[model samples]
Target chain A: MARLSLNQKTTDRWSVAEAVAGCVRAGLPSIGLWREPVQAIGVPTAARLVADAGLRVSSLCRGGFLTAADPARRRRALDDNRRAVDEAAELGAACLVMVVGGLPEGSRDLAGARERMAEGIAELAPYAAGRGVRLALEPMHPIFCADRGVLSTLGQALDLAERFPAEQVGVVVDTFHVWWDPDVLGQIRRARGRVASFQVCDWITPLPPDALLSRGMMGDGHIDFPLLRRAVEQAGYAGDIEVEIFNAEVWAADPDAVVATLARRYVTHVLPD
Target chain B: MARLSLNQKTTDRWSVAEAVAGCVRAGLPSIGLWREPVQAIGVPTAARLVADAGLRVSSLCRGGFLTAADPARRRRALDDNRRAVDEAAELGAACLVMVVGGLPEGSRDLAGARERMAEGIAELAPYAAGRGVRLALEPMHPIFCADRGVLSTLGQALDLAERFPAEQVGVVVDTFHVWWDPDVLGQIRRARGRVASFQVCDWITPLPPDALLSRGMMGDGHIDFPLLRRAVEQAGYAGDIEVEIFNAEVWAADPDAVVATLARRYVTHVLPD
Candidate 1:
């Protein structure tokens, strides 16, 4: 069977362990867990469940929001990231994805803010490698470029990856962030095997300036997933195709149903040849 | 006094001729007119006032929505673009900036959607060039990826730029849309003098999802205009920065106040070196 990983965030309706167990039960070959899910059930128990199900942990959801201007807080962020890497390693995850913080809170210096992000990533890259985890930097959508992730383009992420060899640092091209990029095809070709993760989600415009939590499911919005997956696979990406949707509606629905629906859609639209 | 270019959409709050005369009398050095404004006033009169006032037309706001699957309609769009180029030439504008269409009315094929965009641009480029007008592709905010412009990242726009030469084609790097790009600096640098126009506006977030028209005025939002301008200038862009705000509140205000406010913000924040 072709590989598929269900990101825990999609079924955030369930706890981390339940998500892991449920994904395995649904016959998914792999799963991705977020820190919140692990924290809810405790990492050890969550990791144990994945092991119990023999589910491959494609990656830990994230470990990089390093935009705090305070040096100590930024250092603590790195320390926490090392812990995330360690946790991912313990769970046998192939990579530790980093969202990389947006503009430091209340700060508008997008350039200095991004420099801090690169510095933060550089600090954690070696630590993540030591923990035996590949660090994947996910350049978010330009919409998130201001405060959530300063890195908003794949070319920028690939540019940073150029600083590290293919082994240590890489990029995660998410449909939610980069589906709209005009050069995504070229950047994916450039990323090739260095693309550590390929995720699927839809971009929705949320109201309330601080409405940071709403996202759509794969096909509910306008994202062209089949083509996006084709681009990633064409770029020599052989890793798990993870479904990492962050939708308020899905989270509120029956977790089992969401997984079932996603499975059906993935089989029809995303399963590799 | 430094140069000022009026985006006629700004004065969409007024009739086209009145808006043009107001801007000319206000001592603005240049102006940008939208298709609707030109249509409302008749292209010849729109062209004549600017010519009579000796106002340099910086750019024509748009001439693309190339996502129609119907070849006849798509051909109509290209033909309309041909007319837009002629109108731009009449007004002595710099380029016919394209917000290259979004998904075809009912389809979700983003890649195919973009292919349609490229095809339209390729079809329109020659006509625009023959009329002494350049096609300036604008990369809008990701929020509009579905219903509006799908080219969301500056890297994407630059990649599109690589498809054509600077003289015949280029891009309009509007900060309101792309200031959040992590690759903004690199892309802007890559844009070099091929930057057909530099547009400035503020970024504001409205809750719930009415973000399309909620653009903030400079100095009122999170954009660091000075830094962005510096990057654009460093990228070898020597173009007049035009304020293309789509703010309802700003637009509702007295046009004079709006222009004066923008000029003040421009002097304080975006004064070129």
Candidate 2:
């Protein structure tokens, strides 16, 4: 329970103040922040609210979309990520989770897209390190590889992360995104020092029409959460395990009830035996 | 065009006879068959029909759902796969493509499920080899890794295939599945003479409600088909290249028009330049 964090997206309707109040009310030790909600209240106000609540910020929602082929769009993406980094630093986030963009419009060259993503990271890692923030590269499920994250596997993320200092660039191990990987255990082991954030969510089938909201509550799906939890723990990721579900049903549920359900599941499904 | 094969599912409305005639009509050199339609018309009649039309059988649709945990269910799966191998031999298919089953009902033990799949392949490989039918394991995309295939990458399939003699077990390189793989080109290079079938289909986004029917026609999605075709060709596989799309729109279209569209896409997107 001490390691549990409520990712704000898990309770989509909650504002920063509402989420901070909700986390404190739920007896949660931490909360993961999204940039939009933080920016709405202004970063200083959001940071002060969490600090007053004595809640740690697990991670910033995202900071990468570096696959833009156009020079102006790519420049905007990098500038936006730099702003995201500033927000993470102000919020005292553990890291800024990176969802590297997929192929550009009208493009089929995956290798080229991935190369651009690497370059984006190389350009950002030093700046992030200077700000005392780590850029956490997330390897989304391959289902999202064409439009979301070009980094489709932890191994691929590591290939890029390994190029930078471990303090500057790391990786996120989101259960829903990586549970299907045959080599996940090995990759998690390899991620040792570079595992910036460990997120928990279940992979549900009959994935909604919008695949983006396909995650389910932990016990309701087929993932053996304890197995992955144990692996991440063994990898020395002594950090908050954020419950970050994106399902529409979850978003529609009463925010307090969603927090209660996830906290209980976190204990039953994710805590080490 | 000489190497192009129409996988029967690409024209779901066609009977075995109609599919064979359609191939001849479309000037396709080969046809990939599904066991259900082949069994529906009786394997002998279907085999004779295709042989009579002088259309080579590229590969049999499937065989390995061998991850059953129950003793009776496991035995039945092996027996069914054995029958599938017999059908492939009777149809003179170059190989029998295997989509290994996912976790058993109410199960979360992925490692155990994968081990069972390996054992199933081991048990069936000898019988398949004796029948002169190679078992071509198809590594589905990770999206299907939970419900459809435990084998989620060409490298994982090859790890299983390489344990058996090359003639006894080979692998299917379906572009739709492996195209998202960062290591696909390297795995294709590793496949070399063990590549049994090369399948092509584009991957479109906003995947239809049923993820199973999500594949798009080539040139409609983001896959670089010619790149994949060239990789398979360089791997020393001169086998029929099967176009195995499963889009609902494709299934509902006029079979001949669908064939014509695929033929054009094949030459434009898949053929060596």
Candidate 3:
């Protein structure tokens, strides 16, 4: 319970202030934020709101989508990521989660997309580090590989992260994305000091029409959460374990009820020890 | 064109006889068979139909689902796989593509399920080898890890395959499955002598509601088909390139048109050289 955090996505209807208030009501120690909501109230006010509520900001939702082949779009993406880094710094977020972009429109060049992703990261890592924000690369599921993320494995995330200092570039171990990797336990072990964030969510089946919202609550799916939790703990990730889910039903539910449910699930399914 | 083989699922509307006749009409030298339709007419007759058409059986549709934890259910799964092996042998399939089962109805023990999958393969591999049929373990896309194939990566499939004699057990490299793997090229290189089957299909986005039927035609999606095709070719897989798609739209279309479109896509998208 002490280490539990409520990621904003879990209570999708909540704004920055609303999520912070919900976290405080739930007695959660922290909250993970998204760029849009934080920027909505402006980062300074959002930062002071969380600080006043006595909550830690676990992470900033995202900052990557750098796989543009077009030079103008690529430059704009890098600039946007730099702004994201500044936002993370202002919010005092632990890290900026990076959901590296998928293939460019009408493009079949995956290798090129991936190479551009790496280059974007390389360009952003130093800027992020200078702003006191770590870039946490989120290795999304293979299902999202065609449209959302090119980094499909934790090992692949680590490959890019390893190019920079651990404090500058790290990987986010989101269970929903990585629970199916055969070498996940090994990859978690390899993550070691570079694990910037640990997110808990279940990978549910009979996926919704929109696959992006497919993440289920921990107890409702097939993931061995305790096994992964133990592995992450053993890998030396002692930070807040954020419960992040992106399900339409969850989004439609009462934000407070969503937080309460995730809080309970975090105890029973994520932190049994 | 010489290596092109129309997987039965690609032409979903076609019966075994119809698919074989379609293959003959398309001037395709081979056809991949599925158990349901083959068993509809029985194996012996199905075998003769293809033989009579002078079409080689590239590989049988499947022969796995071996991850049951219950002893009785496990035994049944192994027996079903053995029958599939015999059918593959009778049809003279190049190999038996195995879509290994997912988690049991209510179980979360992926490691346990994987162990049982290996044990089942160990039990069936020798029987398959004796019948001159190789068990080509198909590492399905991670999207299907919970409900379909627990084997999610080609490297993971090879890990299971290398534990057995290559003649008894090998792997199926489906482009749609392994395309997202970061280590896929290296894994293919590692799969040199053990490549039993090479399946090709495009992975499209805004995946259909079923998710299972999300695969698109060759040029209809974002996959770099030529890249994967070249990787398999360099892996020394001199086998039939079976185009296996599972889209509802493709299924509803004319089977002959599907075959003709795939034939053109195979040349332009798959084997540009």
Candidate 4:
């Protein structure tokens, strides 16, 4: 099994400087960094800080929202993803995670939006591969099907994976997103080598209004961690199970306390001895 | 196709009497009745009113909440559903829909609770079958994955359907509960003869906090109803497209307006002309 990592946004209270320092201080092995924080601290400085602090980049925070029906707007999204891929390459991240966008704004045509998403990602896949950055398509929860991601199931991601030909394009296995899927176990088995990232977080019972980012912390919700961990591992994903929660309450707490607590919980509850 | 039906609770303003008359005024073929107005007006009187008003009963409000986890509580739920089955049978309704309960009150173990739901449904299936009330399992949206219904996917309902091994235990496809599914078209195909009921509402873009209910009226949200109707029709389901929108605002409006608008929309946007 690979090591577990901390996603930076989970400890959003800290700036990039404090976050990296605190992660290293906590003796964690791997971490994922988002674009905003990296840009805020400067990519070179952030990369140097991560290297100086001896932390491995599990994956870069994300790079795709390719569902605009307009060709030029789609091209612009691809251009932005190109920048993200460059950033991921700089950080030596394992993968450039992509969150494919949902229905094109104001468009009730999900099929059209999904088609646009596929074309947009296919356009970016080669650019990402050229830079040695693995493009990871993250299928978010079905609740985000209309507003956040059209690829709301792992099976949909697997279908997308088939179009990649080679394993250059991959999928993300986020427990918070796919935990409720009855076909999750089957899709993970099917994903095997095509899975580029594995994310862990609790699926809270009752989600709040801004369901897009109101993620629950580990052990605070109803997902079965051991079962999910076993499924992802059995699927041949030897990658860090990055904790990527977005709880407002947790983010408002002390950075060190949050990291320490997450590290402890991830070790005790998530990681198998 | 069975004629379109207007679900009364979608227009919660007036009483059941008003909803029935509104449906009649609009020339709707069928209507979904609620238990509230029945209780408010006494079941016998409400039954006479609906019968005299000449509205075809598509289905009785609901039954089954099988997840108390405790046998005593589960038994109470069964008792309630048994009575509901009788009520639905009395109404000359086509089916008794069940929104099988989520994790037991304040419980977190979803898997175990789902097992309890299956067992409860299996028990109720026989009684409902005997009473000539088709048992329709309405798999809810994933947003209600924790405390409402663990059976968040229609595939899960089909899997459960295999256990009862009868026409009695079937599914009710409500767009509001399943529009976000990446595999909805496939499931509708899989549903085939097992679809005891069919419904239409809409998936609003920014999902409301209260998802179990907050369904938008058909054509008001993102669901492509004609496409969905075509899929179900292709799957051999020649049944009523009962519009079951649970929005509080829709309910608080003029009941007649709500019914009339839905009837008009069904004719123009959803149903095949």
Candidate 5:
């Protein structure tokens, strides 16, 4: 229970204040914050609200979209990421999760897009390190490779992360995005000492019309949560395990109820025996 | 142009008779046949239709889904696959594409599901070989790993295919599925003789509400068709290149127009210099 964090996205309708209150009421020790909610409430206010509720910010989601072809857009993205690092620092987040952007518009060069992402991370890693924020590269599902994140496997993310210092850059093991990788267990082992965060959600099939919201509540889908948790724990990631489902149905539920459901599932499916 | 094969699903609305006629009208030398359509028109009749038109059946559009948990259901799947093999042999298809099933219902055991798929394939491979049909494992994009095919990369497919004789087991290199893989080029090289088929289809973003229909016409999406075609050719595959798109908009268009569009795109985006 101590390591269970309810990512705000599991109950996306909840305001920052509401999320903090819900976490405390649900007896959760931490919460994963999204930038939009924190920004809406003012970063300081949001940070204070969570602290006052005795909740730690497990992670800040997110700080990357580094694959824009236009030079101006790419520069703006880098500038924005630096600001995100500052916010993550202010919020005392364990890491700044990155959903690196996909291919530049009208570009068929996947390799080129990946190169740009590496350059973006190289430029931002030092800035993030200076702020005591880790850049957590999240390898989203391959479905999102073209439009959301070119980094589509834990191995790919780790390859990029390994280029930077362990304290400065790391990888996010999000179940929904990577549960299908046959090499995930090996990748988790390889990611030892550099796993920035471990997120739990389930893979539900017949993905909703909008694939992004296809993430399911832990027990509602077919992921072997315990297996992933054990692998991450074995990899030395003894940090918060965030429940970050992006399902429309879950989001429509009451925030408190959502938190309660997440806690129950976390105990049943994710916690180490 | 001689190697271009119109996969029936690209104009899904077209019946077997219509598809055969359409291919002949477009001066296409081959067509990729789906089991449902062939079964509808009767396999022998459908085979005769293609043969009479001097059109080759580039490949049969499937025969696997071998990941059922129920013993009875699993047996049924194998039986169906045997029938698919007979049809492929009857049609003189270069290979029978396999879209292996995802995890069984009420199961979160991906590894186990994959094992079952392997067992099923091992059993079917001999039967396929006996019938003079090659079993072509098509690794659908990982997004479909949970519900469609556990074989999600060409490397994974080749790993399984390598376990059997090349004539008994092979792999389908579909651009839409394997384009995102960083190791795709290397995998294609490894596939060489076991490269049963080379499929072409562009990957469009903002995937339609239904992700399955998100495949775009060549040149309409982000895939560099020539790059992939070159890799496949370099791998020593000199067989027909099948255009297998699953798009609602494309299907809604007239079949002749769709074939014309596919041919135009094939020349502009897929054909080598």
Candidate 6:
């Protein structure tokens, strides 16, 4: 009954079949899928699996690494993203989340890298729109700006998203990424109707040796989930609330247990009163 | 000779006396001191040492951790900051760099924490100005916003600094922290007269296990130093270009060797042509 969705990465061990069944067993209405697992099972089979279980594919986890320096690589990235759009449409995903790539290897031209990301998005937006799939620009935390994502703020993501039609391109309000932004609330409000997805996770301190795994369970860290949830709701986002945590400990835990814990945390800490 | 200053922490192994002497030996005209080392050698003695070496104290490394939940601790923080002001004045440093503390322990009220920082700065500004020391608000990278400093953007720092007179308050344009900020160039331009100090370091990826030790030498990471240097110079900030790296490897190297490498990198990668 709680409109909570589990992002596949949160349960790293779960295969496409396992994750779909786990969501059904956990009574989760939706699941956010990654292209890897879905591709591993083949898109049509994966789509049928989720549909047969009567589960919504909340959003596809990623389709952007568009900042490569090589022309061939950039072209390949665009081509691959087009395939991801088709996959999202086949799966009936609400959006295709993008983790825009960081600086090209050994290059420090952040502006140039950002320009490349915008260009990639601009070229892909029409293709995605044609298939009725939205492009969700997930501005990662600034710490990941060097290698993970060049889009470092919701404002920046919105700046790019605003250039496209709201249904074609929008921004993701991932708490782990935008909670530290002083202007996040304003950006969230500004992103009204352009919010393609809302993801939840907590930010733990003394980050892991690998910064990528620093996201904790919703209630385990400093993020005020209810506060963020309220902001997203006020921004006109009445969509599946995806719990996307990436941590070694979380991944090591049993997938069903992780889903149960996420559901409980969502009701307790994230659902608005 | 360029307007370069060697921040002592870049050569973490050097004593206060040795750092001053090393700066002089390296033909560096200025040195930035940390309060711990200056207090270790006694402020007066450290001041005299730098004076004897014909070295200017570019800026003192910090004087703000005011985001405390407890009233008594807040008062103590203000007291310690006052002492830091006295030290900066005694050492004839240009400013007292403030890395305003992050969320108070067990507290998640980021807005409250940032308010505490602003209040602390407002309370300390007059005291610092009275002693002829400017308060340099250093906006740290957003990654450190949870535990180290909540001031995560130059724009946020300036928003706070603009509250006080420019002589009493200013912002530090540290390359390592602000390079990931998309609007950094515009913020630097806006920080014109209030640009208290300009610090340089690189942002290498796969950050060290201890995030605090991740600052790399100028040429070793992804920052466009000359680009930043040009922005600062265009902002009318004719101040010492301090090389303040915080890497464990850099700290382990010989202090003289570290200083020598920093000087060379400053010329090759940082100094605007």
Q: List the residue pairs that clash in candidate 2.
A: none
Lowest lDDT 10-residue stretch of candidate 2 chain B: B203-212
CA RMSD of each candidate after superposition:
3.3, 0.8, 1.1, 2.4, 1.4, 0.9
Reference-based TM-score of each model? 0.88, 0.99, 0.98, 0.93, 0.97, 0.99
**Native contacts recovered, in order, as a fraction for each?**
0.68, 0.76, 0.92, 0.68, 0.69, 0.85
DockQ each: 0.47, 0.82, 0.86, 0.63, 0.76, 0.88
Please write out the lDDT profile of model 6 over residues B138-246, one tens digit for every residue: 9999989989999999999999999988989999999989999989999999998999999999999788888989899988889998898999999999989998989
Native contact share for candidate 2: 0.76
Candidate 5 global CA lDDT score: 0.91
- TM-score (chain B only), all candidates: 0.95, 0.99, 0.98, 0.94, 0.98, 0.98
Which residue runs of candidate 6 sit more than 4 Å off their true CA positions?
Answer: none
lDDT of 1 at B208: 25
lDDT of 4 by residue, B90-146 (tens): 888888888887766556566788888899888888888888888889898887778
Would candidate 1 be rated incorrect, acceptable, medium or high by CAPRI criteria?
A: acceptable
Better model by DockQ: candidate 5 vs candidate 6: 6
On lDDT, the stronger of 2 and 4 is 2
What does candidate 3's lDDT look like per residue over A1-273, in tens digits?
Answer: 888999998887888888998888989999999999888889899999999999999999889999999999999999999999999999899999999999999998888899999999999999998999999999999889989999999999998899899999999999999999999999999999999999999988777778988889999998889999899889998999999999999999999888889888888888775
Chain A of candidate 6 compared with the true chain A, TM-score: 0.99
Give stretches of model 1 more than 4 Å off: A165-167, A203-214, A234-236, B21-26, B48-54, B106-111, B150-167, B182-193, B205-208, B230-239, B252-254
Error of 2 at B155 (Å): 0.8
Error of 2 at A242 (Å): 0.2
| 1 or 6, greater by lDDT | 6
Comparing 1 and 5 on TM-score, the stronger one: 5
**What is the TM-score ranking, best to worst?**
2, 6, 3, 5, 4, 1
A15-96 per-residue lDDT for model 4 (tens digits)? 7788777777887788899999899888999999889888889999888889887879877888898999999999999998
Give the backbone clash total of model 4. Answer: 1
Question: Which residue pairs show collisions in model 1?
Answer: A102-A147, A207-B207, A207-B208, A207-B209, A208-B207, A208-B208
